[model samples]
Target: GTKTISYGCVGGDFNEVLHAWEKEGGVPRSQRCLDNFKEAFEYCELGDLGFAGDAFMWRNNSHTAEKYIKERLDHVVATQGWCARFPAYRVVNGDPRHSDHRPIIIDTAGAAAVRRN
Candidate 1:
């Protein structure tokens, strides 16, 4: 019999979106870019931890509306085995304040107690 790895998680600024809806106010992301991200994610057996708060976690901060853009480039993902250990886990998108990208917070205890904008 062989044992399998049961715990894994990946979190960071992936700089890629898995779907068209993950972005706004910019030219549509190429299909290849979306497909590539999806493929790599699935191949790694990662499950999106999901998020609570504003949908977009990053902004271009352009003064002009037309040039402004927003996207969910940051992410938190974990393997099914890892998720089982913290079923109450929650991912929160925190206020950027000064940066263009929002901070990502993962709370394994349950709903995160953080403010979002």
Candidate 2:
């Protein structure tokens, strides 16, 4: 099980898996794809760092609001072990690259610790 040696944060244009509906609590997610994602994560023992910033990272980029529907496709996922080592990771917002999706930066450096007297 743990013998499988895999490394690296696999990411990029996933083009799917929108959490808008989940965030809104309108309806349950489609079981098919959700199941697949879960299975993959479990197989890899990945930790969902949770999404940050605007609910929707990508949109249709159309003039009409309806056509400009947004969704969270781009993400920063890390292996269970990886997160334990670097808990300060964050998704930094960047200029849109002439596309509907906004560029994201994964800062592995954990946030600075705060001390109170």
Candidate 3:
């Protein structure tokens, strides 16, 4: 499956889902949503593409640690076949600019795909 898939997943404050997994701070608890989220990914056959740059991709724009919240919300994922195309698929999470959510860049800049039939 030499297919490739790339998408910018946008959901309503998905950070809550991650926090639920961590059992930490963020939005209110919602085990139902969390469970469904896990099932959804399993159903869709999607997984973490691993990432580079700042581990934290977003911040709540708060100076106080007590109120400040940072999370890796932005990400990239693909099927096993797609990942095989670029063995070195790297995700560079750029620093936040004029927005709370930072930019996401998939870096295959040095990937040299093998020619096969």
lDDT of each: 0.84, 0.60, 0.59
Return whichever of 2 and 3 wins on lDDT: 2
Model 1 Cα lDDT, one tens digit per residue, 1-117: 453657787888999887899999879999999998988777778878899988798889699999999999998988898898877788889888889888888888764333331
Off by over 4 Å in 2: 1-3, 18-29, 95-97, 113-117
Candidate 3, pairs of clashing residues? none
**Residue ranges of candidate 3 with Cα displaced over 4 Å:** 1-32, 109-117
Question: TM-score-based ranking, best first?
Answer: 1, 2, 3
Which has the greatest lDDT? Answer: 1
Worst 10 residues of 3 by lDDT: 3-12
* Pairs of residues at least 3 apart in sequence or in different chains that clash in candidate 2: 88-110
True-structure Cα RMSD, model 1: 4.4
Clashes of 2: 1
TM-score, candidate 2, is: 0.70
lDDT tens digits, residues 22-113, model 2?
Answer: 32222445778767866776677665566556656676646764444556666666776667666666666556768777777777763643
Question: After best superposition, candidate 2 residue 52: deviation in angstroms?
Answer: 2.9
* lDDT assessment of candidate 2: 0.60
**How do all models score by TM-score?**
0.87, 0.70, 0.65
Model 1 poorest ten-residue lDDT run: 108-117
